[model samples]
Target: MIRIIAVLMLLIPGLISAYGIKLMRDTLFNDFHPIFFHIGIQFFAGFLFFLGGVAFIGGFIVYRDKKKKKQREDN
Candidate 1:
């Protein structure tokens, strides 16, 4: 479901970001390619976090409003 997907978006990106950081920290860099790749991954992780937060908040708002609306209708 959408909720599951949103949660996964947060988790997967977080894991990838952590792994990327660890890789960059534990390895010696002599070339530009690894640095560039890390930057790209970090950017992607940032984007995923932003999108996931939006989706999670939006979904919560929609669900709350819908529930309230249904209660009003029942009254």
Candidate 2:
């Protein structure tokens, strides 16, 4: 159950990151999602989403790696 939850958490952020990329790409083509009123805002929001998601996933990996390394050293 714990593993399933973890996978879900990771999957959500991965999807967000992909959507962010799509948003940015669409902005470049002068296409905008209705929620965004301005082109610049859309692009900026996309940038933030992409970076935030990636940072989260990256941090998770780093934390897990450190935990594993500590366990190895302890044994």
Candidate 3:
């Protein structure tokens, strides 16, 4: 369903960040520039969050309009 797909899309960035952090910790460069890794993850996560929020809002607006149109057509 659309809702399920939307939820999964929103979860993608968190999953990516978790995997990225794990990979970074496992690598030899883990001790160096830790702040960079954290910052990069935060930036990506924030971007994804914003994108997901916009998509959700757009979907709601579309659904609302459709419902109103359907009601007017029935009347």
Candidate 4:
């Protein structure tokens, strides 16, 4: 159950990063998303979203790994 919950939690950030990639792609093609008034703003927001999501996922995995390693050492 905990593993399943972890997988589900990851899906949100995965979707966020995917959306960020889409935004960046649209910016590259000169087709701006209507959410932002300017191209630069859209691109910058997308970049932030991508980095934030990736960082969250990376940190979660790193933390989990360290915890597991500690448990192994204790046993």
What local distance difference test score does each model get?
A: 0.56, 0.88, 0.57, 0.86
In candidate 3, stretches whose alpha carbon ends up further than 4 angstroms from where it belongs are 1-37, 70-75
When 2 and 4 are scored with TM-score, the better candidate is 4
lDDT of 4 by residue, 19-63 (tens): 888888889999977879999999988898898889889988878
Model 3 C-alpha lDDT per residue in residues 19-45, reported as the tens digit of each score? 555544544443444554575564554
Residues 16-49, candidate 2, lDDT per residue (tens digit)? 9988898899999999789998999999999988
Residue pairs with clashing backbones, model 3: none
Candidate 1 weakest ten by summed lDDT: 24-33
**Candidate 3 lDDT for residue 63:** 75
Candidate 3: clashing residue pairs, number: 0
Candidate 4: C-alpha RMSD after superposition: 3.7
lDDT of 4 at 35: 78
- In model 2, residue pairs whose N, Cα or C atoms come closer than 3 Å (at least 3 residues apart or on different chains), thus clashing, are none
True lDDT of residue 60, candidate 2: 85
Candidate 3 to native Cα RMSD, angstroms: 8.8
* Residue ranges of candidate 2 with Cα displaced over 4 Å: 70-75
Question: What is the TM-score of candidate 4?
Answer: 0.87
Query: Per-residue lDDT tens digits of candidate 1, residues 1-75?
Result: 988976785566556555555444443443234444565554555455556655666666577678787534444
